[model samples]
Target: MTNKDVYIAKMKMQLDELDGQMSVLEARAKEAKDDARAKYEEEMAKLHEQSKLAQGKLDSMKSATAEAWDATVAEMEKVRDAFVHSFSYFKSQL
Candidate 1:
């Protein structure tokens, strides 16, 4: 397979993994206590938003070449960082 094909495959796999993680997080958030439930929901919402944004970015790169994969990777990294920051802050509060 070509490099672009490989990149697309990898991107789709990453997105699937993120979707699975989001689902698990959502379940955990729903199971949280009354006081902590709000914070958990907020964090889960942030993650869901980031995941949507990341999926959009990945979709936009459908016609991209191997060289353009870098941009997609960078966008995914930003999303990951945001998720980490939000998760960490919420964790610290609880």
Candidate 2:
């Protein structure tokens, strides 16, 4: 496959992994005690937001026009960095 195809595949895989992680977080949040559940729910919300943003970025990357690929890639990189930063912050809080 072409490099773009491979990249897209990788992005899709990462998005799938994030979705699974969010599912686990949601389940954990639902099962926790009152105070801890609140905290877990808050963290899960933040992660869900980040995951949504990442998915948006991936979707944009996948659908970008040929002439716009460079700019789209740059924006996707920024989105990825933001997602990673948010994930780290969320992990630190837990």
Q: How close is candidate 1 to the true structure, as a TM-score?
A: 0.72
Query: Candidate 2's residue-wise lDDT over 1-94, tens digit each?
Result: 9777788888778768767766765775687789888888877777778778888888888778889988987877787777777766655555
* Model 1 lDDT at residue 78: 75
lDDT value, candidate 2, whole model: 0.76
Choose the strongest candidate by lDDT. Answer: 2
RMSD of each: 3.0, 2.1
Q: Write the per-residue lDDT of candidate 1 for residues 1-94, one digit (tens) a residue.
A: 9766776678778768767866766777788798989878877777778777777776777765667777866776676567557655655554
Judging by TM-score against the true structure, name the best candidate: 2
Worst 10 residues of 2 by lDDT: 85-94
Off by over 4 Å in 2: none
Off by over 4 Å in 1: 65-73, 80-94
